[model samples]
Target: MFLFKRPLISALFRRKIQYPKSLNIKPLITFQINKMSTTVTIPEKQSVIYYDKTGGPEVLQFSTDFPVPSDLASNEILVKNRYSGINYIETYFRNGIYPASFPYIPGREASGEIVAIGSDVKNFKIGDKIAYLGNQNFAQFTKLDSNKVSIINVGANATDDQLKLYAASLLQGLTAITLINEAYNVKEGDYILVTAAAGGVGLILVQLLSKIKKAHVIAVASTNEKLNKAKVNGAEFLLNSSELSYDQIADKILEITNGKGADGIFDSIGKDSFEMDMKSIKRKGTIVSFGNASGAVSPLSITRLSPKNVKIARPQLFGYVTEPEEFQFYTESLFDLIKNGDLKIDIYKVYALKDYKTATIEMEGRKTSGKILLEIPN
Candidate 1:
């Protein structure tokens, strides 16, 4: 539960918006999971994008008669969503590449307001603005464990729209944060290469690695426009992944690093980028294959690492944020950076929740940049 008590509620609910004057941020107040009764307004059934079988986006069927939970677990909170983020990973679930149960609601992350809370819920109350990344969040209202949600403090300075952007965008930002800070700690002056640098997580990685960690970031994208967008986000160098072959890109990276090669490579574009990732890093450097945007990287012999002491890691978002401490650290750190203006959220397109199929099409086609959002109708 770990919900904040009344004394800390003022901090979470600011009356006036003012930016913190300095980066000397205070630690978040700690609270235990406690239970309390709360009254809420709700409906018995709601519309949702559901699927009875795994397939493509075509399999998704919108229905209005889906039964809403009649009871909340003591540790649960109910959210009426305003927006949900669309990630490529959902396509994996929709396609049966990732195992899922039938009649599934296919969404992983959303931003909304708490409309109800179970008796044991203590920190969050009805009408509190919040956001969560979890399963079955594609519906109009989704129930979540109190521990698995974040309070979107609409400080006097941040508007509801701004907080909604934070909610829709945090998942990718957190992924990038985990990639750089935890999976492979990027150091000052480190030459790091990021694939799909104009894409959601890649764009965030470019900004954070270059601006926050002081790393030299090289961006790989599909077009000149995306490359320029990455440049604006602090990418020092660029390579059009579509224009050049992987081998050529690897060679260019080596040339950029003055033959020493990149100190580290954060690759989300797997498959075609796999061998290049191995070839592009310096001796003893690490290559993290965090996603399969270009499809899964086929199995490689462990002996490949023996050549130049190259290391490859495949880290997942769920694995990194499994611990409560780590989860809070990453999510809060991301929000702090946003509030401090160290990171920016670029939402390239917004679609109605009913247009999810089109959103997935654009996302999968790599036709959009930054983040794509689905505005859940009230």
Candidate 2:
């Protein structure tokens, strides 16, 4: 029995929430074979999306029968992925929105049926359908720790088919976990504004803040589709991201609070909504700036925060997960919320695994609402 000690919770959560860790030649999951092929004439290849050169979606190409290692480890679960989800961070890494080493796999989330399990594995069994958060999901198959993937966290008992919608957004839940636990110490009836409310993180954050944190949520999005999604999830007020300037948005936010600004603003769009987040909040409000979809945020000084007796902080999963105590606290808390139906995952699109190029383009162009998935071929 591989008891999940509290110390290794981050490794387990990677199987559920975030992508694979830094590849420091570490294969927590490895494969083994009894009689290995010596000739090596035909490579054990896994079809993957890669770019020989970085430019755009056109640069991404797929190759079949890519060399897949046969060495096996006991606790790792090998999944013949049925579906994988896409996210913006993957896009940032792909479009060079953030720098990365070239010739890398592009996607972050996927769900697949477990095809094989190592000898030491427990909890998950062979042939169970599962989804996980990780890198190299662009490949046809990958290994994951059994402790990390959950069986019914999202699909069957999930409310109204919308539960399945958020399976790929395990990463979104991850970031939301950190923000809820670390930054604000949010309380019931606290008002919050989730910018990019229709986006990967904002959509999930809306529900978590409302249902779990017991806070009132205001959603800020760029489109009708997004607004509806956010509202359906739990947002009490929806503001058009495209129509509102900082002052205009601020006015609407204050109006929603009856002239009181929100207690918290979850702004992932960075500069586009930075000042608005500051202006749209009550005294001592906490503004959490995590991503840079619009652009990166520069430093903020104590002087700027002193006027309202407020605070500004950047929230990331890595910051919380680095500490085992915090890691266990967050992962357990988020899953508990999901189990109780407080936080819902919304996946707007499901593409065939072969449709990698199409999915990436849609995600990059912001064409989809919640999470996008790649259904792997069995």
Candidate 3:
């Protein structure tokens, strides 16, 4: 499978972009560039971590001579990445479980400043601070389709810490946002269960579901420390997944919910938690399987779902934001929550780009609590 997603606006920008009535996306706010703050210089080559044949983190090689793409499609924008967010899904690609093109660049999300913009780009300009989630990342500099970019206003006076936090938090933060708000439509007074609840996405889900939606959040993690972190983030109840079998986990969930089970169960740890997730949800409750941290869940027979009248949904971020307008709406809303202090970005660790292997090792072992990040040197 091709690991890289094509630029979002690469195809649409060739034609006239239009917004559907349902989206209600405001017109693109074009920022005019007057005197350029600094004439950002580009290097002919940039360092990147790449793997020719995927296997383990050891396969990744850091090369300073990696050639930067000189060609730019009309809708593409070049960003000088300050920080790159790491996700476990990238490890799947690196381990060859997910097919990828040879010499793959394994990063998916980042925050940076726009050093260059294509001629057809309208909504952004040079020096604009932006964060993006897409393919062909894991490098000091990356080119993103204009539509895929999220503008982060880290004005001239912004500090390096502010930029790093926003950039590193984008993927996990936005995933939690869309998952709670759209994937399962969490509402007030619902009982929600989150597997791997102390994880990057899990912590955010706990905060959003409990604090924002007024839902009862039951968090499951492998360690007491993680579970405690979940509690600090507003999880009302906690269970250590490592301490209980799937059936026992289900039983505990039922006890917490007064034998009714959870109204919504979000399972990111797929294989081990699949059975627990099914038994822990109430009739007609929604079960959203978003990740496969433990291992991929096998396909279930329809009869298994019919017995409980439960609804199952597997949501991927790419599928949710295929429409430019919907993507814009979600991105804006997520950032707005951050701006209003309704959400906090909890970053677990930051490593230099050259320390890619150690970073992946920590993430794969589940040693980190929140998002893992790569700090790209300017």
Which candidate do you rate higher for lDDT, 2 or 3?
3
Q: Each candidate's TM vs. the true structure?
A: 0.87, 0.75, 0.88
lDDT of 3 by residue, 1-378 (tens): 111122232222222234336345454333332222225778889999899997877898998998876666667678888888888888778876689998788888877788877776676667777666767768878876665534443544446787777776677877887787667887688999998888888988898888778899999988899999999999999898778877898999999999999999888888888989888899989999988887789978988888789999898877766665556655666666666677777888889999999988887787888777889877
Q: Write the per-residue lDDT of candidate 1 for residues 1-378, one digit (tens) a residue.
A: 112221221222232212233223333322344453456657788878888887766788888788876577767778887788888788878787678888889788887777777666666667777666777777788887775534443333435686567665778988987787667877789999999999889889999889888889999999999999999999999999789999999999999999988989999888989889888899999999988777789988999899889877899887876655455556666776776688898889888878888888888888999988888777
Question: Compared to the true structure, candidate 1 yields what TM-score?
Answer: 0.87
Q: Name the regions of candidate 3 deviating beyond 4 angstroms.
A: 1-23, 27-39, 147-158
lDDT of 3: 0.77
| Index of the highest-TM-score prediction | 3
Q: Provide C-alpha RMSD values for all models, in order.
A: 6.2, 7.3, 7.1
- Give stretches of model 1 more than 4 Å off: 1-40, 149-158
Any idea what lDDT model 1 has? 0.77
User: What residue runs in model 2 are displaced by over 4 Å at the alpha carbon?
Assistant: 1-43, 70-77, 113-130, 143-166, 258-260, 299-302, 322-329
